[model samples]
Target chain A: EPEVTQTPSHQVTQMGQEVILRCVPISNHLYFYWYRQILGQKVEFLVSFYNNEISEKSEIFDDQFSVERPDGSNFTLKIRSTKLEDSAMYFCASKFNTNTGELFFGEGSRLTVL
Target chain B: AQRVTQPEKLLSVFKGAPVELKCNYSYSGSPELFWYVQYSRQRLQLLLRHISRESIKGFTADLNKGETSFHLKKPFAQEEDSAMYYCALSGQGLTGGGNKLTFGTGTQLKVEL
Candidate 1:
């Protein structure tokens, strides 16, 4: 079975530094998303991308965050000036269609900000 | 605002016992509900969706619109069922914004021997 793949399984960064998490979604998937989960917290939606543009975003996805489908297979999330609170597990997910509403998630990338 | 609530943080049951993972959501419009599971050291994956109305791994969840719940139920649970389960909701339709999932805090199910 094809699955979404994410890079940098674990990343440690200093405060005020920049970090970029990459993901390669399933080849045929049309919709992609980025979500994060703080330790012991629920998974929170950050942003969704389709057609090479952002479709929607949550308050957590503020000016510090940006997502790009730099290529046909690569989707990335960049956080500028990371803060201590930004430490969390970021997940990349993709969906084949709207009818099923089933999403395939990648093994999250753990980001640690000191 | 769409929110998913899984009241139980941890649930333990013996093998062969029945299991129920409670899930509730708050949404004004029609919502698409799903149950995702993550086994030990495994990536989060979809377990079932309300639209399918079909059971997977002998687990079934009925979407109770009246109570805004989609609780997962499984009779005679096996030890392999031990995992973390999350209930999620989506507010998007066929022609609207992207498919953004709002997930619950998740329930850790431990099927003991």
Candidate 2:
């Protein structure tokens, strides 16, 4: 079965440095989302992308955060300057349609900021 | 704002015992709720949803609006049921904008022999 795939399963970056996490959602899926789970915290929604633009974002997804579907297949989340609090495991998920309400999730990329 | 609360951080039970993972949500509008499970080293997978109202893997959950809860329950827990379970809600409707999910802190269930 087709699944969402993420690159750089783990990334270590320094504070004030830029970081980018990449994801390739299921080919036929339309809606994509980025969620992050801080160590021992609940999974928090960052942003949701559909039809080429972000539809909604959480407060955590502030000025430093950006998302793009640069190509038909790749969805990426970039943080301009990493902070110690930014260390978390980010998961990418996709849905085939709006009605199903089931999201297929990727393995997740663990980002560590020091 | 939408928020999900999973009261228990961890739950331990013996094999063949009944299991219930508590989940509660605070949402103003009609809620769309779901249960997701993550096994050791595996990606999060949908276990069931309130909309479907169907049982999967011998587990079931009923949405109780009056109680503002959607708890996952299994009659006889198997050892393989050990996993982390999360309850989520999408307060927004499906059509207009991105349906971002608000998830609860997961409950780690350990089913031992």
Candidate 3:
């Protein structure tokens, strides 16, 4: 079965440095999303992307964050300057339709900011 | 704003016992709820959704609009049921935008022998 794939399963970056997390959603999926889970915390929605543009974003997704579908298959989240609080597990999810209300999540990328 | 709450952080039950994972949400409009499970060493996967009204792995969740709850229940739980369960809600109706999901803190279910 096809599944969402994420690169850099684990990343360690320094404060004030930039980091990019990449994801390749299911080929047929139309909607994509990015969520983060702080250690031992609930998963928080960051942004949703459709038609190669962001549809909605949360307050956590501020000016420091940006998402891009650089290609038909690759979706990426970039943080301009990482902070200590940015350490968390980032998940990339995709769905074929809104009606189903089912999201396929990738293995997740663990980002550690020092 | 939409929020999901799972009151129980951890639940333990013996094999063959029934199990119930409580999930409640705070949403004004119509809500689409789902239960996702993460087994040991596995990625998070959709266990069941309220819309389908179908049972997966003998687990079923009923959407209660009156109480704003969508709790997952399973009778005769097996040892394999040990995993982390998360409740999520999607705001996708009128006046609601995007398919973003608000998830609960999750409940760790341990089916002991």
Candidate of highest lDDT: 2
Question: Which digits, one per residue and each the tens of the lDDT, describe model 1 over residues A1-114?
Answer: 898999999999999999999999999989999999999998998988888788889899999999999879999999999999999999999988755657999999999999
- Give the C-alpha miss distance for residue B33 in model 3, angstroms: 0.7
Q: Which CAPRI tier for candidate 1?
A: medium
lDDT of each: 0.93, 0.94, 0.93
- Across residues B1-113, which tens digit of lDDT does each residue of candidate 3 receive? 89999999999999999999999999987888999999997889999999999999999999999888999999999999999999999886322334788999999999999
Residue runs of model 2 more than 4 Å from their true location after superposition: B93-95
**lDDT comparing candidate 1 with the true structure:** 0.93
How well is each residue in A73-94 modelled by candidate 3, as lDDT tens digits? 9999999999999999999999
Worst 10 residues of 3 chain A by lDDT: A94-103
DockQ for the candidates, in order: 0.67, 0.66, 0.60
Docking quality category of candidate 3 according to DockQ thresholds: medium
Error in Å for residue A4 of model 1:
0.5
TM-scores for candidates 1 onward, in order: 0.97, 0.97, 0.97
CA deviation > 4 Å runs, candidate 1: B93-96
